[model samples]
Target: MKFVRTNKDRLVLISVAGEIAPARMRSPYSVTTEGKVKVIPVLGGITYNVRVGDSAYGWEGDHVEPGVSVMARKKEEEIPFMTLPCIGNEVIVMSGDAKGSRGVVTGKHGGVNHVIVHFDDEVLEKLMVGDKVLIKAWGQGMKLLDHPDVKVMNIDPDLFEKIGIVEKDGKLHVPVVAKVPAHLMGSGIGASSSASTDYDIMALDPREVGVEDLRLGDIVAIMDHDNSYGVGKYRKGMISIGIVVHSACVSAGHGPGVVVIMTGEESVLVPEVVERSNISDYLR
Candidate 1:
């Protein structure tokens, strides 16, 4: 990986959880395959114990969490939380009981613009929705020096180092839990960029590669996927690296969501499957 300097002005300190809104539904009357109207927590609360790759249960829509869910002050600030903080970025509690405690950016929720951060169990006990957290916020506009064709998206430089990436045979070799095919990519496809949203893993078939085994925080590669400018359009010879953010959903064109971390054209990325590849293993 190569480093490119970005303007310092792009970096900003953002606050968290300005309001504790009630859990929402995309469609209040939506029903699951079981013919039951499913309602589940979506934001602004500490969802205990669940980690990356866990099932989202019967919930429908984005920002579903198995852990703490942190949102920006309001809808206007959603863009910063979604696009600025990269996976593995350091987050510091700025106020409330957990003040001064630190955590790691774990994932980004699609559609709702929520960012999930993980702290130690003890710290979580003291955390509150009104507490403020600060992010260093410096990952946009970075690129690979060796591979110009590859585009880095929403990845902090320091966080990227911890992802266990290496260069071999003139291609970037990334350690990932699973290798996903382009056809399985569901919602959020064709978007202009991945900075603010994520694509879904349409895990309709259990036998598909990496679909059944996906875990939250797992790094996976989408073959033939392109997200040069936040959009997830498909093309030959392109690849996108992402992390599992939310759990699997029963909705059509929806399953586990993977937020784009890094992407590049063919010859820029190659993925190697490692059984234990998960964000928790590295961050925790």
Candidate 2:
């Protein structure tokens, strides 16, 4: 397949940096599947074992985030850290044992306000909770000339080009691992802005619909979804595309989280499920 080209040169890239956040569990015991309460891992900090392409369920933890989690020091700085960088942007370890190691931004969790990054297994072993990292943030204000309604957000221009997207019959056909309906969307739906946080897919049962085999780093599409405005709404004939950033949650109205990368009207944007729709597969 031919690569999808866009006005990448016209996009202005920014610089954002932060430190690895500490793992936090709001309460000693938290909600699980069917309101069951238990103690487990949630978000923030560096995860030594889990990486992309891993399962999203059957973990002792709820809403488990893969890879290293980063966030700015103060509220003022956190805003840029959460919103500026796009998925696929370059991440550099600026401090600690993993100093100078390179990585890529994968997802942004809203409530926790942590940016997820994937590094090599060696780098993960070296990364610490307080280690600092910098992001070469880009792809915030990107435009697809051929399709104006399609709004591109937190996704690197280079990564977008690599996605198996083809313009067909006056519509943009996007290759995705799953096609999630709007009703299944749960937490982070009404966020102040869609650029910062990720929306969740309420998949209590792993065998649910199109997202049956959903895994971390997999690109999926949401039907009847519109993120062009605020956090977005459920409007008929709309489609939003995003990446599965975190693990499945046992909590009610919570599951694997997906960060929006692109969205537009269904008339011009189309999602097609394919076997190789994960970043792990695409990067390879």
Candidate 3:
């Protein structure tokens, strides 16, 4: 069955499913319906409305996808503006309508889910629990990936916008943006949302490593040196796309975690890249 939503309101972040897809499942999940067991496809791996009867449950380890709604942790702080992180990290809305708002960051979950920040008590009192937020994306090396020349495995929508790609001509036109050799990507792909504080790069292209170059809302591809996606043998070709979940950090065996990218149509893989476009510079 197809999902129903306005084309403009399409989702980028999706939660994980307990039952694997046909390809991922050694044994798929099913329930007895009448006499036959049936498989269920939980959309976005989550239920938008939380209820006791809901099939989904919250997990401490699960993170929020960027661009999703979040409320303030409390109502004490004073935020003059609605804040969005350029890099994923814990934040407290210091001022504005959401002032005194605080939330643990669930990392960005969808293409539009560029910065997922969770909220707590104080912030919740002053703000609604789920409010669509505006983010300011800045920094360098952020761009779009287009062209049939590469392979992309598992992706969401937010990364698509970050790369600056627009669908046309019955094919995706990924621009020639900057690329980080698969060898340079850290071994642990998922780890920290606050790269600025949680982890650090043991090694990075001195040219590409820096806060100015990597900022919030930037789409990037992790070079798959081992061809983990099986695009082929150790060829310098396969690239796994993901949005930077946070800034560079020094997490154990992990640097910056990425909200893995995915494609909505056709089983085609496209390379991801980094580019700069946020005019607000985190002010939004």
TM per prediction: 0.84, 0.95, 0.36
| Model 1 lDDT tens row, 1-284 | 44333343454544433322234566655454455675554444676667654643334434466566677777787766677777777788888888888877777776666677777789989887667778656677766766667778766666676778887667788888777888888888876558877778876554555467677888888888788775668788888898888877655677787888788866758888888677776674
How accurate locally, in lDDT, is each candidate?
A: 0.71, 0.85, 0.32
Best candidate (score: TM-score): 2
Residue 173 of model 1: what lDDT? 84
Among the numbered candidates, top lDDT falls to 2
lDDT of 1: 0.71
Is candidate 1 or 3 superior in TM-score? 1
**TM-score of candidate 3 relative to the true fold:** 0.36
Put down candidate 2 lDDT per residue, 203-264, tens digits, no spaces. Answer: 77868565767789998999888998677598999899999999988788888999998899
Instruction: State the displacement of the C-alpha of residue 244, model 3, in Å, after optimal TM-score superposition.
Output: 0.9
Q: For model 2, state the Cα shift of residue 264 in Å.
A: 1.2
lDDT of 3 by residue, 1-284 (tens): 11211122432322211110011111244332134443443112222222111111121112212222332223321121112232323345544467544443334322112234434334444543333333232211222234333333322223334444545444443432234454445434333321211111223333454323543334444444332322212335444444444333222232333533322222234443435432112221
